[model samples]
Target chain A: MFDYKLLAALAAVIEQGGFERAAQALGLSQSAVSQRIKLLEARVGQPVLLRATPPAPTEIGRLLLNHVQQVRLLERDLQDQVPALDEGGLPERLRIALNADSLATWWARAVGDFCAERGLLLDLVVEDQDVGLKRMRAGDVAGCVCAGDKPVAGARCIPLGAMRYRALASPAFVARHFAAGVTAAALARAPAIVFGPDDQLQHRFFAMLGGEGGFIHHLCPSSEGFVRLTSGGFGWGLVPEQQVRGELERGELVELLPGRVIDVPLYWHHWRNGGELLASLTRHLEKYTGRWLVQV
Target chain B: MFDYKLLAALAAVIEQGGFERAAQALGLSQSAVSQRIKLLEARVGQPVLLRATPPAPTEIGRLLLNHVQQVRLLERDLQDQVPALDEGGLPERLRIALNADSLATWWARAVGDFCAERGLLLDLVVEDQDVGLKRMRAGDVAGCVCAGDKPVAGARCIPLGAMRYRALASPAFVARHFAAGVTAAALARAPAIVFGPDDQLQHRFFAMLGGEGGFIHHLCPSSEGFVRLTSGGFGWGLVPEQQVRGELERGELVELLPGRVIDVPLYWHHWRNGGELLASLTRHLEKYTGRWLVQV
Candidate 1:
């Protein structure tokens, strides 16, 4: 069994980029910080940090850092529940990965509020929903808000809600490109906006409409750019309802498929044994998700 | 050795997200596409293209795909030199990754012009210079233009030049925040914009000015957002000269350090065996980079 204090010290050294700074941050002597890391490495039979200017954690060290971060979150949760243990010394951190759509729209505000209220720092990584789960599996994050319900071993998969998406185009774009209606031939000739080459949402929407044309013609990988470009009449694109809700309501963007919502289920996957903090976060996420997302 | 045609078919299936469509893309029957992929997998004694709606390549399969993409680029390069082999069937594609700063500013137009002239499809992935190299190492990209001189084992590294950066803030911001003068005490209380947590540019500038404060106060991961936020007087940042050259000229953004330029050297890294196509592409990049970037 690894000592929590040692793990914390190792995390500090890697995160602070050196021992001296970590010592200052931790309010411990530099000698103490160095001794703790050396002891941890001796126990693990491997050196933790690759000594460089702003040292990087070795592979084994990264795994240890992940564990330490998870433990730190859990301890903070415990401290909250047992208020007597709250020293109010350092703020805890929650490491999570989110999809770009969520980051660009309603979810950013929601997560920001939650983190603020809980007095937690968020280390959020943005990736595609399709690829976000890879980070969770690699131990780079405590949890990941990603697409699909494919559960991994040793993780709790909670279906948050279905994020409704729709095909949208500016009024002029529909008139210019799809004057004959959004038919197979029309779509084949029309340029479409895609997040990236791997983005499957647009293709999924097209397949639903009984037509699959070009995969990626106008690539706007940034989520904000995707919304603006599609809304500016550059091309028709499948965009999250949350992102285009204002545009749709104001008549700035017209829905290509009226009343047809392609629902992609989002699942919050976390370590099954991740204690009360993970449970509390999951509850908050599920509640916030239901307010904004369409659930069946 | 892996069969190039079979590997091409595999890439199409993973990219297009289905066998039927990969067949459509390759102008082959669905059965033929499946047969080619199966034959390649059988020869390698491993399954590739994990069965999903949009099929993903298995780890080994991804390796094969990367190799195939590299080979395709080289062949296209060869065809250009030996014009007799140009039957003019399909346009060749070049997969590359670029830093976002370069993309948002000057390099996009340049790359587009070169690709148009050469009749090559440019698939560009935007990532920070630090992380962009990982994509090249993983074979997700054929080449990368990124910061630093660290060359991959099998790749050639050419120093394009330094990308000069300066600490910039709007006139209003300078008047408001630095009325007390730019000192360590004042800076410690100032809000600063950073690309992300791992971004060290702002801190590097601060260190150079003999001050260091909180690393991340406001995070704006988008390069375009960073420039806009810094220019809007939200916070100070170290922005690329190429990106903010116009803003500096218009006096919309004032440089904190007039003559001090933080020069980050950018290098073009590609496979040593990438040959003719890579060579031609490098020349174009060098030309464009020189036009917009400082070569000394």
Candidate 2:
């Protein structure tokens, strides 16, 4: 069997992008990190790292890194179970990765209930749905609610549900920007909230509007922040109905393009084992969000 | 996060049904196995094993055992990929669980070319479709070519073609049992080869004959052997057409009931990871079997 410790060390080094940084993060001597990588290469029977500027992982290394990340997550879960055996003090910690929008709106209450029921200490990592798997693969989180159907290696995935997005804007923002009744031409001049460089809501909105989402943008990283920004009259956004239900009902956030909506499918991804906690959490979330998200 | 090692040990004991047996199978001392069980129970904060007759797992134990099995299979996959780093060695070992009928017929040959080209080793575990998931849950196999859509908790499942079964009998067997113009009543009186005590083909055939399959008296365990027994004049059987192609062509085996065939869907289950070896194998199997099996 391969030495899991060495593989883990190598994975950390690759992920951190430098021997010095990895060594510092892991609290190991630089030589020790270097030696571990060397040993891992020998065990693998091939050079796993591309010894160049910034040092990148080779194809085989990438595969091994995925395995190492899984092992580490499993290890952390094992560690958490240790204290539970004693007095059940220090409630088990649950580290979950999730998309910004879901985390901001529907997930917080569910997460709170999860923490309360299990007495679990919570560690939430917020990221875009597209990149949540990377966080899962890097051992940064134990579970993720993501948008992709394909799972990271060594992680388990199930369809937790999907979210529905509609083009929305603060009534003030719309009244100020588009008096010609929310056409593609009117949307072109409107400022919109962009989640990040990788965010596709703007693009999707443009596609629905029969044009591209113009560069007049306000960038917000958090889903809740994005919603708040949009509601505060910063710009238009494809807001999940659950997040802006009250605002829309009260006419604070107006549906800019009625009858045009996008369904974004979401899935639950986590380490294949230690699924009970995650399964229970899934059940809780499903009960509340079942009607809001599209069923696939 | 669960202790994979302890969970694996617990599952081993459940499968083996005794500490000694489980220890022997795992190559660990009986004391070690006992300690592992104690540790696992301690970790979960509940008793896992019943410790009664046969030492079966409790409900919680079964739940964790299921998770452990998934983890072990994924771990085996990681181990299987180790040899791929070697120069021109076998890339991986695919431990596959498949129903007897599929194994005996087109699946083996369909995958033969791909396995040969990649020098991939296959560990085949033959079982009935109903019990294949149990084998998968027990960590006996990494993937399954079975009939079902209900996924194993942590595995990825996709439809991988289907097969049609037709009732067949040797000319001698039919001639000895029935006169010309054999009817459903004649089939009920004729001795038939049931795949096993739990085999449903005979029951399905009887259902088609407007009766139940309990009418079958003789039972054979092997799919290949079942066909052989039928062709040797023991009895009639519901056989895959692919298995008895030569027999049907040479007048050795005759279709007992013409124009009546049963279509059974098949699916492939594997770890969700994008393993190249698995991807290649699945591609080859699907490409060949898609031509014969039902699309849906």
Candidate achieving the largest lDDT? 1
Each candidate: what lDDT? 0.72, 0.66
In model 1, the runs with Cα more than 4 Å from the true position are A13-38, A44-67, A77-88, A113-119, A130-143, A149-182, A189-198, A212-296, B13-24, B27-38, B41-67, B74-90, B103-119, B126-140, B149-198, B212-296
Report i-RMS for every model: 5.4, 32.7
Give the root-mean-square deviation of each candidate in angstroms. 6.6, 30.1
Candidate 2 lDDT (Cα, 0 to 1) = 0.66
Q: What is the Å distance of residue B11 in model 2 from its true position?
A: 6.2
At residue B247, candidate 1 shows an lDDT of 78
lDDT, candidate 1, at A294? 77
Candidate 1, residues B87-196: lDDT per residue as tens digits? 43566666777776765555544564555455555556777766678877888777888886888878877877777888888887788778978776666555566676
Docking class of 2: incorrect
Question: How far out, in Å, is residue A83 in model 1?
Answer: 8.8
Give one digit per residue, the lDDT tens place, for model 2 in A1-296.
77866876776565444687567546678899999999888888998899753467887887776565555444545665674443212233455677766654455444444444454433455566656788777655677887888888877787766788988887777887787787777776665666654567776777776874233454444454455556666668888888667778888788887878888888878776644665576667667656546786
| Candidates' chain A TM-scores | 0.82, 0.68
What is the lDDT, from 0 to 100, of the residue A45 in candidate 2?
90
Worst 10 residues of 2 chain B by lDDT: B83-92
